[model samples]
Target: MELNSIKDAFDRVAKKQKLSCSKSQEVIDQIIQEIEKALGKIQPSLSDYKHVLSDLRTTLKDIAPLSQLEGTQKELNIALSKYAKVIEKSFNPDIAKAYRNIEFDVHTVNQIIAIHFYRQGFFDIGDCFISEARELESAASIKSSFLEMFQILEAMKHWNLEPALNWAANNSDKLKQNGSDLVLRLHSMQFLEILKKGSRNEALKYARNHLTPFSSDHMAELQKLMACLLFTGRLDSSPYSALISPTNWEKLAEELSKQFCNILGYSFESPLSVTIAAGVQGLPPLLKFMNVMAGKKQEWQTMKQLPVPVELDKEFQFHSVFVCPVSKEQSTDDNPPMLMPCGHVLCKQSIMKMSKNSTKSFKCPYCPSDVEATKCRQLYL
Candidate 1:
């Protein structure tokens, strides 16, 4: 919410700035036109220069260009001043108050940074960073895997598919295990490229050889792809025109990168990218919480959790988060969610407190059944 508000503020400031500049430019243009008219009149009356100068002064007084320009300039200055205040109001400068000082493993941090660079296809930079951190040996395997992925992506940029097809074929089993139809997709892209060349027989042969395995499972998709063959070189004019859409190339590239990372036991997004994205999403609440705590003379940096919930978007959620209904607290390792024999769930701490550490039974919070902590098994979300 804070980020959106800041963006909206910036947009309003930008609009005001453009309007002010436009008004100022209009006044300047008008002044320039009046001066040019005075010059033209003087040019034709050089012999009567003194009279012309007097007339020019009178014309300037009638137009009052300086006054108009001064008004426009004042509006601009006012907009600029308001813009600075809006920025100050929109974002807290004391963001450091929200931070916690904690020890971090230097080696682990270096490895993560190195791997992030590698995953982002910054091979040379990754090598340099890891080498300076003395993590080249530890990060070599990851770099090699990403290097292969980047090689495939590089080929893709030039409309080449052989490298990608080979990688897909080698990881065929893994792709299937990961529930990815990358092989079929790759083959379909190739088939379409062949059709674009007006090679009907070649496309058919390639489809039979490479797309055959996915035929039964993806019959519906295969049917649609096959429909493109009817258009051959004129696919743009065919009923299956969308088959040749430029977006398909971009989508396929993204899907390929995702599957490539998935097969390598990694997410398509680099950890650094996801962390920064999630952090930015969560920062506004943390900053707000810190300011609220400041008035009460409270120290929040040493705390394990924030007083307010930081709601992040779904894309930032990578794992399950179970909040106990009884205590309204999120489950952690020490306070894991527990499943009762009666089928209700609560945090272990909540259950322990209710049952007095399993010394006695207590009525279930949601049902009439009596519950014991010993009868509750840890439930992994």
Candidate 2:
């Protein structure tokens, strides 16, 4: 909502600026036109035309565009001031305090961020950062790997698949282990390209050498591809036309990126990107909480944990977390999750409390199993 308000304010300022410019231009044009008319009326050979010059000046002074231009400039200034205030109010001056006393190693952070830029193909920026930070060795190791991946992706954008095909084939075993059908997908795209270009025979041959191997597991999709051959160059009008959607290329590129990252044992997203995204999602609540606790200086300063939970999407959830039903507390190293014989999980603290400091067996909170806390196994995520 705040974003919308800011956008509206920006739009108003832009509109006012354009109006002011148009009115100013109109005023200048009118004055020039009146002076030209006055000059045309005066004799070219005559050095005297004082009355004509006076009339031109009077006409210029009476022009409505001059007053309109002034009003527009005033409106433009008002719009600009309003936008400035909106921007100022939108920023929370105390937001920086949320990172109070947190220590960061500048060199290490620069190296990580620089590597992230390199991985995203911002080589010049990354190089500059590395040079300034003098952390060449740190970013040098993974640079070539990301550069190669980018090269392959760049080729994929132009519908070339040979580089990706060879890479996938060389890493065939790893792809298989990871259950990635990247090679098959790449081959399918190649086959579709052949079919699109009116080469039915080539498409069939390509599919036979490629898609046939995956028939056992991908029989349905294989059948669809085979049916697409009937349409040949007219696949756009075929029942399987959805297969030829331009978005398929985008989806394939995304899938290829995921497969590439998986093969390298790295996350599909850059760590820096993920960190920034998570921060963007979590910062608002933290800022609001800080504003609410502004009066409690000592309490906020000494607080080690957030008073409220910051919810993030499942995509950002990188690990399993167990919250104890009894205590309504999250499991940590000091209070690890425990699995009872009844298959119910609870934090160690909750189990300890329920078992009365291991003095006796306790019934499961949601079940009838009476188990000893000592016998409960620690569960790791």
Candidate 3:
């Protein structure tokens, strides 16, 4: 009885290990019994099943957790949200439509869309602000805002923006204290432009009143303003006496010459004894050379002065004095024979003699080397 109990216990353990159900275990036992009975009559041995049951039991322990995968999915969603706006701003309409359908907050997405519209030239700046305000349902400030000021000046000549100008004038103190240098510079240029068309006393008064006081380091700006006033015939020469030093006068002369030449056809060879810009005071060396060239009174004024032979040796070596290329003339009595590669000058007769040699290549008069006559350039003289 004890031996029977031990055998039954071993059979139960084997059935549990094989994952055989109670109902299936009885059927398996009957099949094993039948197989064992037939084994005596059978001739060959074969495998029980094609797959290993142990390997199937090993795969049940390695399942993935849902929490870790959910975290990754959340991160992917956030990343997608950030990039969707960028994709929506692309030039391709199909790409934009794909990005627009992506789930994300609408604020940044709409801003990016508006910016893209502006970049694609769909709307001008004024219209862009109008659209932005309408979409946002917000009231915008009208006075001294960057947009307002830009529009004011954009339409200033045609539109009587006295109110905007008055606001700018009244807020000059606050603007200097709080506004950037770029803003101040913009205002200054605008003031100058407006001042150009104003009456003499009125313009000066408005410039002095509205514009910031000039700094000594900004002498260039002061000079520019003075030049503008003088050029417009708003101020007489006597009023700008302090601004017109001799050096400043020279600069102004060159500026006027350049401006007049650009407007008309030619610049003055020298100062017209008038006020010009103050920066171009010193004459460039090229201008100095041109001035000298223009002032030539002799017959060689229009011609370049070729080098003249100061000394000549029996070996036909000629030493010449150098002159400007613009002053040479065939009429000069001091014409010198041009030197060749052999450092020897030959007269016209010697050159003609070389030209007669058809059978043999021309040789240098002073040296035995071939003249390489085919490569020789004709002498300009």
Better of 2 and 3 by lDDT: 2
True-vs-predicted CA distance for residue 209, candidate 1, Å = 3.1
lDDT of 3 by residue, 1-381 (tens): 534555555554554434434434555465455556455434354353223333323322222223424544455455455445444432224211111123656654454444333323345653565565464442132211334433443444343445444644665565455432333343444444454465556656656764546544456765666455654433334454334234543443333223323332222322222212211232232233443454443432333532232222333322343332323333233433444556544443344457563334577755786654333433434
Tally clashing residue pairs in candidate 2: 0
Q: TM-score for model 2?
A: 0.75
lDDT of 1 at 350: 91
Pairwise TM-score winner, candidates 1 and 2: 1
Tens-digit lDDT string for candidate 2 (73-179): 99999999999999988766666756556579988788669868877889888888888888888777667777888999899888888988898899999989998
Q: What is each predicted model's overall lDDT from 0 to 1?
A: 0.84, 0.85, 0.42
How many clashing residue pairs, candidate 1? 0
TM-score ranking, high to low: 1, 2, 3
lDDT of the structure predicted as candidate 1: 0.84
Looking at model 2, the pairs that clash are: none
Q: What is the TM-score of each candidate against the true structure?
A: 0.85, 0.75, 0.26
